[model samples]
Target: MNRKTLVLPAAAVLLAPLLAACGGAEDGRAIVVGTTDQFIANEDAPAPLDPAFAYDTGTWNILRQTVQTLLHVPRGGGEPVPEAAQSCGFSDKASESYRCKLRSGLTFADGTPVTAEDVKYSIERVLKIKSDNGTAALLAGVDTVEAKGTDEVVFHLKSPDATFPYKLSTPVAGILSKDKYPADKLRDGFDVDGSGPYTMKVEREGEKAARFVFTRNPNYKGDIAPRNEKVELRAFADAGAMGKALESDDIDMMARSLSQKQIRELTETPKERIRVTEVPGLEIRYLGFNTKAPSVKEKAVRQAMAAVVDRGALVNGVYGPTAEPLYSLIPSSITGHATPFYDAYGDSDTARAAKILKDAGVSTPVKVTLNYTTDHYGAETAQEFEALKKQLVASGLFDATTRGAEWSTFRPAQKRGDYAVYGLGWFPDYPDPDNYIAPFLDSDNFLNTPYVNKVVRDQLIPRSRRQADRTAASPVYAQIQKIVAEDVPVLPLWQGKQYVAARDDLTGVEYALNTSSDLLLWELGRGTA
Candidate 1:
């Protein structure tokens, strides 16, 4: 599962926005998409569409259409190409200084011309707000941004970071109008202003966006063209309902949130009118340890838990074939991925786990409370945790208890270190090894754990970042993964595979997902075949 979204019956809500798009659907110029992705649209911190705070893939899917970035990953995943910018690259060989030339005649959704100052303001505002729920830490390397002129922008980095452009390709660096958004505060609304391929109008039901209606933006001037005139994204409570909507012809596509059973039915049975496409995904689920916590404070205790986990059994039993066992923070699909955990502790060995505890002078049946978010990670998550609890307890060397909360409360509590151990998922902000390793191990890490290794934080990551060629950084990343395995700051669980189920008549369903797993709705349209 990518993220959260509220569910509503497809036929029940005939809202005006949806009705308008429905009229165009008859002509094959309009398409309806269903997803289980969700976001919070409240006054306090985040409001879904705010570029600074819209960090999840669900929100990014909507933003990718309406909010334009300087660069963008191409259809079906590849190197990023210019979107709002005509050209962008590092100005120096060290990958420390980067520059971009914006495409001329660019205009925001509000009809205001987009200038370099707006780009500068957009990047700076994200850094200034620095919301914990946001991806501000991705811009940690940036020292300052300068608007050289109306069409040119330069970024001066605190250090060398070859992955910076990939970060820019994400919605984290989405260009917004300076006049439309405040410099120091998150824009507190579902409305958005950008120069992407579509103009979006959000229909709200309380704090949730019930539906997102996107009309083709006539003023959008970029590398890609919209294949359809309109797209309506319908929110489903669960994958079951979303699948039903696709089967009943209520929606043309179901993306990012399909359950394993739904995927199996779509792929195995071969629905004549429907088809499913599977792509390699960068999404991963893991367990984070509050290293200062009493129970897991000892390195041996954490290592014991890691050695006892049977990733193969957990993935196959709970997730079917939809997910694969993951040993490293970086997925095998990403370059520089190494299996240090497997190298250190191979498979489930209760004797090995017991010995680890005994060597550390720790007693048997060490009580540990495991926490997880109930609502966000799909229906199977509860089963996954239950399976995990059984595994730990079955080892006869530990006592494990499971606790869960809704995402709204769970995330804040995890950040506060309320739980000794918690499970969380990561979908890449961009498709790179740095996106996997840096976020957890960096100085101001997203995990907020007390575990710190100066060598990994200060030396290995920075050394890897300096290489312009990502492949050249492989050995450094290998060392970093080994350190993570040894320390057990966070235990890697499983890596996911992306799937999208759409009507067989859809033309561009195969190319709708980009390199970073962000949905590009502009690629979808009715097919002649």
Candidate 2:
């Protein structure tokens, strides 16, 4: 099993100013934001809003900012603060159960009371739809979710889950209205009814690249302290177009998916016009290999494949200084970040890669389909894939084909492991390194790679989960990354240094520590001072 260190929360303010350059919202002005996505998928429908099921950071960020949770990871980087639940802590350590007493007078957008029954239903829904959504795996070892009344809900776990409340802090844990929901269908694209600072004004369906919109809920009196009354999510298909729109004041801000060259130009532009915040990012991009594939069952072949990736080149040519080459699945900013793969197989050596394949009795060239996403990540994604293809071909051990889909199409395909080898980037749903390891390494997870380390699956992850406090779980996650370095089921590519460009006049933007993708809208307000 892996050994991770205790989780030490840090201040998220360091890189939050990146979104401040758009020069708007100084005094109660509405914040009009521009994002890489062209559409906003229904945050509440049958889709995965639960943190355990939802892996995309951007989605989680938007959802969390808009919804009410029982508990929350605190802002400005400290300990977790309570929300829907007024009082929460380990109710019983022996059984690994967590208990919480809900806050009074908290109601949904419709002025309906958020009761314990709704909380129970939300927890049950994660496990019930786990097969396709898979986020329920976050609670796999949990036993039952029992609520005492409208004011108290207790999580009874099969094992210890110290970070359980953080799980509750996710969109997945957003309490659903017992009236609108039924027991049968928990499909994606269902209209969401959440208790948060904002409500869906105009949210598009499957075509999230089409139209996604939200505004502050007049009834919302939750943790999210939104600065503006209305926030518009303007979608641009291309980063180039998005940047131009920002320059022309057509959009107030641009997110991290902009091209590297574009970021440079934006950053180098007069600071008075733009602002940049380089939060030591922890978005870890990786190449997932389906170990279940008959051909990929060979460990030697996997090792050879890991060897040929030139991570340094990827950062220099594709991402520039705003990014860093990653050898470990966990980034350095996180507590247990380690470069296990780099320790084992650092650089491309075609001769060695070829020998490893040959020693495994593989004389025929291996064929693997590589997948990429064009819309979700950034413009350089295609270039990164082409670089990978050339590097692998140069190794002479394999021939590869590259394919890509828009974010809407690529995500489902990536989760299903439909492609032989696909590139996926994880912006953590929460801060801890365990969040990174557990989601990807868990045997029952979406990748379904069939790459099991009994020690990890059965021991370490459980060990980390049961610890009630953050400090207790660290050692387990650290060891998990170390062991992962040796197995290399997925190759770590680069850690995205999060950058947001905003008008210099905008203020109060908050960021999460490392890869924990929490954007506290409450902390953002006009600069009245």
> Of the candidates shown, which would achieve the greatest TM-score relative to the real structure?
1
For candidate 2, lDDT tens digit of each residue in 482-502? 778767788888887766666
Off by over 4 Å in 1: 1-29, 43-45
lDDT of 1 by residue, 463-527 (tens): 99988789999999999999999999999999987888888777566567654667878777775
| TM-score to native of every candidate shown | 0.93, 0.88
Predictions in order: lDDT: 0.84, 0.68
Pairs in steric clash, model 1: 4-37, 4-38, 5-37, 5-38, 7-236, 7-237
> Candidate 2: TM-score?
0.88
Best by lDDT: 1
What are the per-model numbers of colliding residue pairs? Answer: 6, 43
